[model samples]
Target: MNPAAPVHAIVLAGGRATRMGGVDKPAVVVGGRRMLDTALDAVNDCARIVVVGPRRSDLDSTVLQTQETPPGAGPVAGVAAGLAVLDAEPGDRVILLASDLPFAEPTMVEALAAAVQDADTVFAVDESGRLQFLLSAWRIGALTDRVRSLGSTVNQPMKALVPETFDTVLFRGVTDCDTPEDVERARGRAAASPVSIAEARRAILEVVPPLPPRSATLGTSLGATLAERLLAAEALPRIAVSAMDGYAVAGNGPWVLRDDIRYAGSSDELELADGEAARIATGAHLPSGATAVVRDEFAVVTNTSDGPQLSRSQDAPVRDDARRRGEDWHEGYRLAVEGTAVTPALVSAAASAEVTTAGVRGPVRAHVAVTGDEIRREGPLRRGQTRDALGPVLPQFLSWCGVRTVADTHLRDTSDSFDELFREVRQPDLIVIVGATGGGAADQLRAALDRAKARIVVGRVQCRPGGSQVTALLPDGRVVLGLPGNPYAAVATLLITVPSIVAALTGRTPAPRQLARIANASEVSGDATRILPAVPQPDGTWRVDPGIRTAHLAGIIDREALALVPAGAADGDLAELVPLPR
Candidate 1:
């Protein structure tokens, strides 16, 4: 804790882990990061980091690794092995850690190190007042003396090294993983926490991998992402040809016209003399000796003693109208790079370049389902029935996000309805379920996901109206996007979320966010990020529509985009814009 003294870390990562079924406990991932990495991160500012464990190839090469004496020996022996490799002084502080604590942070270590004022060592006490002997800070002299006194460090218990009357600092987040249930509890707690929009997107990207690439013809590859760079197979203009219906003259001006007429798609090759001119049509290949093509409007024809002579008009611009070979692109030239979308323009360009097939990921096919017994899609509505406004238009919204909806249907609010729907469908890459994201009586999607053994990536978000959204990945590699039953909230969440899902599934590069200054952001900003419709004013700034209803999309009829106003934003603040599909 001294300002001038150095601090080193000794992490005990070698363990039998009988309670964890002999698995590598330090390598176990919690909260998207490895537990061993958490311990190393807590001591990242230390002078040296020594990990006492079996050598792991995934560890950084700079980190020092050593095995305890006689290998399977206990924590005391691990401490001795770590101290042997450190070149620390007697007064230097040593942070002792067990690599199973996922929530142990550097602040906790600093507090423990600072609390060692009147004692030889300082350790943490958990919420239950149980001392965490391994999560401690010790003076190198004291630790060395204790290890030397113990003599044989093999199979020693932690109690043998614990100094009597050591100082203790209470910590709340130093929970350690000792069993499978503890690991699961940590994972559940991490998943249940609400994340910001950026955090949610980052988490989705970290967990979801792109689908495997496959070769598909350009005709069938529309909406797919290019897996490799698209190169020109051949030149745009295979050979020199006429750009207009003009004369293919052999040399400059006042030339005698030839008798033969050159038409398009004709392969007849004829050489032109120095003073000869031939009538050439558009797209027709030029003769071997032709230098340029003069359009009919730009040429003057006159009868000569032998034949008709062609001359350039004095008022016409002096220009060559012949299309040159390799004008657009030559062979081996890169047309599109990897991760580019296969839009109509790209397809046409590839076709023009004579590229027939390409390696690509998906266009992300999705299956849409609108859940709720009270929602009716057609026919006369009963007293409690509400019309399904989102079911019909969900595909259009998804299309704007680059997802093609394969099928859409209505699901009743029965307990087994979601389970049956998931079991029946298997082709689509995504399943979009509207409603049933909350904990209401009719909301059975979460329970069905549990039965399906899906991995929940984003349980909830820290946003208004759309905070109840959920994104999960099934074991079969399909994604499930759960939206609120409210139509406006569904559209708002879809606009902001589906793009990330598409990128995750198809390996498409995420587009940069569109930012615009909102003139009245303070009026619409709330404790959580507020997503609302907005209209563009005559000026460059946007005007927010703060008081729109979420039950339907009527409020967005005249809106240009949805403004993502940040929490606690002031007037004239910049907000991200999600443009509505026209």
Candidate 2:
């Protein structure tokens, strides 16, 4: 095989699985992933992947997609259609695959490539001695010739394109699902279980579509993710400038010093001929004929017969302290890629690159509503009234997570309080409702969501102290993030879950996981995944307060993070750490 040649993939996914009742077979979920995703994973190393089927909304927008000449004609016709849109050299390789192969491995393609060196095509032989024609690799040139030789590709059996003398390699994981029983058997390989915290987060990320992006000045887009690549509008330091407070010298120093002093922001035109030097301040535009900048410390100035002259110190090391044009970035150079968070540093970098406005999703504007008739945030608290501890500090916690809290209000416990909040002229992208998530007489967030025709992405999480949390999408595109009423539970759930919602709303890349070995994981672990207050040790491990109360945030006062200790965790197992605001 030519190593320099590129390999392209054609995933045949348009087949009408009549035996499976015409369901989208490629989209069938088994082992917590779509079968089409499995197929795509197998071809991840290819130069490009072309899926021959109807455009799938869930598929990555970058993937090339097309359909057979007549939809669902056959795999042979699907191959011809895929080749129509495929961009590849005749010498490059092509890996044709069926989307229903849940167990297919990329190694199968490698093995086929090795065997196809001696033949035009190589097929994989399943354990049952049946050849999987679709799970094969082909020489692009030979495959195209065979395809062109055929009179008509429509309704043709895949076997018709097979060469008389093709090679075969026996490999496991070549299983294909043709019936419901087959899919069941594939799913049966993995144990059935309730969704874990990790699973819940993944579901929210996959299900929540990103909000539309809008152009905003970088000053107003802090914490928002870049919807498009941030390219430099113009070069950084658009002109050559001095990097130090010194003289802009031409040729070797010991030159005649000019009277003009170029200060920063001095746009007055200046120039220096050979054997000349001009006093220049740091960041000042260099004179027309300047070669380098000699710092004050590196140069000695002497009054000459005609004028002052500049010369380098005998002990000074050689250095050119001149910042050239485009030193930081050139015009049109990409400063940040799509999905990058607009951090403070990013904002400054964009400004340096002369990018003033960018298309961004959000720094996620959220309105926080504390629900309960008895809750009070005032000078005095009456009998049966509790001080609102969560409402005031929720914004600080949200700010730490990059969400901007726009409004904070108390929601009355009446039936229409939440209904009215939903129907009001909504401006914030998210409504964080603290309380009313559980099933109770006063808990009406769920009912209000139903009345508003909202889609509940997460009805309840499976973690302790925060199991009643909910995440829903309103019809008008606002997200309703319901939190538990207890201060600590609400905080813990907010810290762990809000990041995902923010990313879903703003298209921000989810922050990388922060994991630390839990020194006392076994002590805090419970029947379900436990979100416990944890303190860090000097040894870089974490310890949890297993007996801490979740009713108030006092237990976490001294803790630096919340350790997500899985059920049945051992003493030193690694646990994900959700950092507390310092």
- TM for every model, in the order presented, reads 0.79, 0.71
TM-score winner: 1
Candidate 2, residue 383: lDDT? 86
Clashes of each: 0, 0
lDDT of 2 by residue, 1-582 (tens): 686677889999998999999999998866556789889998988888999998888788868999998998999999999898996778888899999998887888778777777778889998888999999989899898899899799999999998988888998656889999898777544212235677557656765778898999988888789999999999978999999999999998689999999999997998899999999999999999999999989999999798898999999988999999999879999999999999889998888887889999898999999999889998799888999988999999999999999999999999999889998839999899999998999999888988988766667666898888887778878888999999999999999989998888888778899999999988878888899888888998888887777667889888889989999999999999999998
Q: After superposition, how far is residue 439 of candidate 1 from its true place, in Å?
A: 0.9
Q: Candidate 1 — which pairs collide?
A: none
lDDT of 1 by residue, 1-582 (tens): 465677889999997898999999998876656789889999888889999999988888889999998777889999999999886899888899999998888998888777764567988999899999889989899999999998899999988998776888999866889999898788667678787887788767767779899999978877789999999999988888899999999887789998889999998988998989999999999998999999989999999788899999989998999989998889988999999999999999998899989999998999999999899988999999999988999999999988899999899999999889888999999999999999998899999999998888888998987999999888898899999999999999999999999888888889999999999999989898999898888888999987988999999988889999999999889999999998
Off by over 4 Å in 2: 1-25, 28-194, 303-307
- After superposing all C-alphas onto the true structure, candidate 2 shows an RMSD in angstroms of 10.6
Mark the 10 consecutive residues where model 2 has the least summed lDDT: 187-196
